[model samples]
Target: MASSDEEKLSQQKEILNLQSQEVDEEYSKLSAILPWDKFSNWINCMCVITFDLELGQAMELIYPGHIKLTEREKSNICYLSFPDSNSGCMGDTQFSFRIRQCPGRVKPMCASHINYNHNCPVALQIDPGHYFGYVYFRQVRDHTLRRGYFQKSVVIISRLPFHNLFMHMVGVIAPEYFDNGEPSIEVACHDIDQWPTPEAGATLNLPLMGTVLQVRVPSHSDKPGLSQNLVVTTESAFSSPTIMPSVNDSDVFKCLFPILPHIQLIWELVLTGEPVVVMANSPTVCSETVLALVSMILPLRFCSDYRQFFTIHDSEFKEYTSRAQAPPPVILGVTNPFFAKTLQHWPHIVRIGDHVPATSNVKPHKLKKGGSLKTLDSKPGVYTRYKPFLNKDKAVLKRLVQGIQTNRPSEVQSAMLRRHFLEVTQSFMIPLERYVASLMPLLRNISPYKGTPRTRPFDPDEFLKSLDFSGPQLTTGIKGDWIGLYRRFFRCANFEGWYNTRIREVNRKLQLLHLEAMSDADLQSWVSGREEVEVVDLILKIKEKLTTASSNHLPVSKDVGEKLYKQMDAVIYTLPEDLRAVLGSN
Candidate 1:
């Protein structure tokens, strides 16, 4: 299969060369295909962003499969593959996509090696035909051979489904402009992909926003769903009880996970010198359509974070096709054509009339993914880029198998590893320590780096031992100040892959023990209560710390802000057994 793909890629390359000659023969006709320049810019940006997200797959393991990045190379032809075979890829769910940007940007090595910047608008083109380079490109024409020069600004994307609108977990390869200095960059859609107008005759919203994932968190004695109360939001599209907690008892926010990658894919295509349709992840999983989901996942701060992360917002929906969210209903019964997100009053999935099949058409299987495999030039990366998230947990759990003396209690090996990263690891302790330390030198006379002034152990086993582990406590400052240097450190960096390493330990237990035996309701209660304290404290301290440093060190705001962002990316592991495990430690 691999060899066949490689050979086909070689053939396609030849075909493209042949086509280029044809293009030259009828340059005017071929060039007039679309707003190639503008579209190409969009595609380039998307590819860069998608690549960036893949690199950020750090502690994804502990969160089940929530931390995911699926990628395949751009081939002369497009082929699709399923990262997870769909049998509960959610809550352990996995999915994937193959993207072809402005074109040439298919290989990971090529993308990784691009000269990156934080200031220039990242132009990442996966366009093999007129592939956009990580570097910028501009058309330069004379009476002679026409030429394209790399310029700043613009990216492109493809492979975005239109049925749903929600938060996207996109990664970006920012042109030097948005680099802010990180390897990857990102953006998000306020909601799922809607047709330019759902009323458009004969178009089917191929992707359903909630199918990819939608958990119906039934309103119980303790929890409630949305009530008919009007709420408000801070910025962008819409505001609801989902992002912001309201006093209403029966309110629910059908929040969607940020669909960052979908946007990235679309932008990659736009950046490619071609005007193509924008597709998103399965519409079923988009935020607006997720009629049911854990309300806790939809935080306004995360929904509106593109400003801080992407440094810009240029998201727009386009036409595309895919499978429906769930089984469809009678054409007449499919009344209100699904609603989208806050970005607009109403958006519908757009399709080029011809793309739609008979209203009663049923697919062999749900839009069977990997359907696009016929489009590949070369079989690409393992999509294992996020493997670290899972592997780290596996490695740790395996290690714990040796240290733990417990006998197998219903698959103890697997149980202990579940939800490990989310609830157990001290993800940011050290990097955060260093980041906090860096702030220390700027805010006070104490040097952040040790030796010359305070050289250090980097993360000495002995040094960690010296510090007490019982608190998000405060330390005495130069005078009467109650500083949280250690606490701040704990939140800033994910040291020793501690978050991954530790979460693996706890998840094993989660998997091994019967969930019925332990009280998930009790656990949920604790999470709800503990979340109030930790979240409030985290947001407040973060805000306060930033403000304090802003006044004390204006010169370091950028650096400090980045440090804060990193802190947020660090996973918080406060599970039921985590503290107990700490206490049991000798």
Candidate 2:
């Protein structure tokens, strides 16, 4: 009996050993299939991270995947993969996050598959829950281009449906600019269903606005499906409520992440010489989105192009379409007829028209040649290579110049001056001050760049060597101040050197329109008769007289002022229709 018992015990021991060996083999297979080293490399390259709101921890351990940027076939693409857990409770709920890449293709899981597969093609399963963001591609400078190479990095996070997996949250690890310089997202979800309530300090190391990220999660009483508000605070020594707020409250899954990227994309397109037309269907989201996109993105250049089209007429639609023809690659929606006419010409069409479409039809202005009304070119940036604000009436052009000098909107003028200064510095080798002085010839009734036969133009090489911007005081000035200082170096350099610019521009238009030769009596007759003459002869007569008096240092008489006022009043009443449109009724 004893021998039989011993044999049975030995058999039991053998069975235990076999079971242990099977368990070890299975673990080895898991390690091989789910290689930690490869996963770690991905995390390192993309800066992948996860934060636990309930635990107050920024955990970077391997977690379930949603979307990621990865290299494929020597090009970068977004890879969507799910995380499989081998450990503790992932949580009680799950959330799905979606991202849309512009110019970059999205390869999603197969339609039949429940989850994303590593081997399938990229395509998103677009449905109700998917919120979208944009990715823009901009070129970096080589040796010649200034400001070094241009690099864009953006991080976008959209709210998700709830799931309590081992992982809490995931986001793109992009360069700061892509996400407006915020890389990590600290999410504090309130009124969550089934999931554990987040503690006050659970989310740490969040990307701060000024210096430090401060998160406060209020205690929630035991309840399910009750809504909770997420309060986020980012504060620092330099942070203020205006620039950097102390508290931010939001819904459990609300998003305001569209503004940064949309503006960035629009600016990138415009500055790089791309065509963009924005039309929205609805007034709220569509119109606001377009406005927000163009508001601060190169305000001087882009603000005018962001037209609010409530409804479209045939001619207005035609004009809208004409402005979008060729050269710059990017094109937004025009009016109906315009969009329909130019549809075949657009290389890529982004249908945002559904957001903000034309609401009403507008009668198009009648076309005129060499008249007061200025026509926008099929390709903008051309004004006979000499003049700007093209096709403006001589009388109106003169008034615009006078307005720039006498009643200038200082802020707008300053911005315009800064833009011109930057344009010069980007291309010319001379100092900004010298460039303005050279342009003084335009004000002095001479050439824009060169002087007349008797006087020599400002030498570019000599001026380049003479620039003394080495002083710290001079170097510390902002763009507007620098332009102001440049203007101060020249006589009548108001409007940041643009005052004289309008003078030369209007004068050139007069010469081209053959109105410069009109006599004083003939011009007066035309002004009184409303003849749409080639030039504002009275204004030019006054300007030339003013220059002569200045050169001779002669004091002007009160009679001169009276004559000017009388002529202006006569012209104002008989002003061309286009000029009146610009000036508007008092």
Who wins the lDDT comparison?
2
Model 1 residue 109 distance off true place after TM-score fit, in angstroms: 11
lDDT of 1 at 438: 33
The candidate that wins on TM-score is 2
lDDT of 2 by residue, 40-121 (tens): 2112122223323343112232122333433331011111111111111121211122222332444442222222111111
Worst 10 residues of 1 by lDDT: 304-313
Q: On a 0 to 100 scale, what is the lDDT of residue 250 in model 2?
A: 16
The lDDT for every candidate, in the order shown, is 0.24, 0.30
TM-score of 2: 0.23
Query: Per-prediction TM-score, please?
Result: 0.22, 0.23
| Candidate 2: worst-modelled 10 consecutive residues by lDDT | 247-256
